[model samples]
Target: MLCVGLDPDQQKFPLSLQGQANAIFTFCRYIVDATADLVCAFKPQIAYFASARAEDQLEKLISYIHRHYPHIPVILDAKRGDIGSTASQYAIEAFERYQADAVTVNPYMGFDSMEPYLSYAGKGVIVLCRTSNPGGSDIQFLPTTDGSGEVMSVYERVAKSAATKWNTNGQMCLVVGATFPEEIAKVREIVGDMPLLIPGIGAQGGDVQATVKAGRNKNLMINSSRAILYASQGEDFAEAARKEALKTRDAINRAR
Candidate 1:
């Protein structure tokens, strides 16, 4: 499934929307309208709204998506991870306050940090595994020995733990980058058919063919952000975004 990332940057918005109070929301609304039919999910990175101090606008944007495109899932990319009470509050913010269908979370603190989110029965809790960013290897690729004395990468351990131990509700997923297709293949092998939120296919230069070949399953959500969202900086911005999204969606399908 194609998951469009609605990460708006004022500096990168179209000229007409640059100085507007609701520029981020307005740009996102048009993009959603243009490509809603082509996507299975919309992921609005919370940092974009938080950076602009427009959390209220973020809420309104999510509400608009729910009202108009209720069938399309909204995955709030907050990557929140914390202790018990704090994690519970974060879960409320992502699932209750914003009313997102799923949320991206960090799992460095172990299963306890993710318990509150997993407890939200119907909602999805996607944990970070092999991230798309370059520096992700710094920690995720470290070697560690499991209880059985078998050595494995940190990301592999996370995949096994999330799939076997933390997936009681069957609402768990992992964020494996498209950039690392080989890692994605390994992760798929470890987790079997669990959904994988694959990022890095667009502006990050991830190979679509490789990602599809390695990560394809019944539940792969391949995402594209700036490459689709900022396809153009003019009046045809939304159309351009749709064109890019269509190409991406088709490319993934062809690869699959």
Candidate 2:
């Protein structure tokens, strides 16, 4: 259930890789090689590469994972959202240019903006439902009535829409933060058996046992980024990442 997130911040890099050429790709590939057998998926946050002007490195890293660890899916955490015309181009960027097995998207724009991505057969499209950030409640927690006159929060509406209406091709999943176990259980109840990408465990201090109990009986990709990535700032970063990932995996299993 543990999904190792590759958010390679150069400032946090080990001494050996700090000034190397192509360090982003090299660092991420090493992490992938070290933890591929320990994780169910790899989530690469796009802003980390884009801010560092290493988009090409991100592409190479994903390609390396595809060529070597093809069994593990790559979820590009772009959270892309746009109009239909522009969303089509963004789809090309994610599915064609990056060749990501799955991509995280913002569902605020509704189904039309996401249709182009869902058009790609066999590719997973994960929508942001209840985000991990504290500010998510500002919008996600607002009460709104559904078509049936039932009151629910925005996140609940998103979960309902993704499960019953928007998931025309069965390629949809929801994002519910690990911080809110009650909300996670509510989402699980709304969307039966659908996969959920649960972020906010390690650096964000979300509990593993509550998350497991809330998200039980469904597919959950519990992601841990900084805690695993910077497990040690030494030459053994990859091994350290693997160890942290293994420890995290064991914790989630024990919770299960």
Candidate 3:
């Protein structure tokens, strides 16, 4: 599945929409309209809207997508994780407040931190595993000993635990970066058929073909952010985005 990330940056938007109050929403709307047919889902990164203090616009954008393209799910890339009570609020924010179909969450605080999200049986709770950032290796690659006296990378452990223990609701998914196809393969092997949300493919320079080869199981959501959203700085931005998105979707299909 192709998941387009609607992470709008004021500095990167087309010149005409840069100073508008609904610039982010407008840009996102065009992108969604252009690629809705080709994508299985849309991911709106919370930080982009929150940073600009445009939560209202974010809500409108999500509502617009739902109202127009009801079939494509929206995964809010919030990466929220906290204690039970706090996690509950975050869960409400992602699933209730924003009405997101799925949310990206951090698992650093362990299972208890994720229980609140897990309680929402109908909503997807995607746990962060091997992230796409450069500093992801600082923690994700560390070796840890499981209770069975077996050693594995922290990400591998998270994958195992998420797949076995925390997936009772069958709504759990893992976020494995496309930048690490080998790790994607490893996580896919550990988790079997569980869905994986793979990012880092576009502007992050992740190899789409390799990512597909390693993570493809017809259960992966390959996301592209800046590459599709900011495909052009001109008025034809939406068309440019569609071209890029179509290319990406076709590439993933071919790789599969």
lDDT of each residue in 108-214, candidate 3, tens digit only: 99998988987887889999999999999999999998589999999999999998898888999999999999999999999999999999999999998899889
Question: Which stretch of 10 consecutive residues in model 3 shows the poorest summed lDDT?
Answer: 209-218
Error of model 2, residue 247, in angstroms: 0.5
Q: What RMSD value applies to candidate 1?
A: 0.8
Each prediction's whole-model lDDT (CA)? 0.93, 0.94, 0.93
Q: What overall lDDT, based on C-alpha atoms, would model 1 receive against the true structure?
A: 0.93
Stretches of candidate 2 exceeding 4 Å from the true structure: none
Model 3 residue 39 lDDT score? 96
Supply the TM-score for candidate 1: 0.98
| Candidate order, lDDT descending | 2, 1, 3
| lDDT at 59, model 2 | 92
How does model 2 score by TM-score?
A: 0.98
Cα deviation of 133, candidate 3, in Å: 1.1
Output candidate 3 Cα RMSD. 0.9
lDDT: worst 10-residue window of model 1: 210-219
Clash pairs for candidate 3: none
What C-alpha RMSD separates each model from the true structure?
0.8, 0.9, 0.9
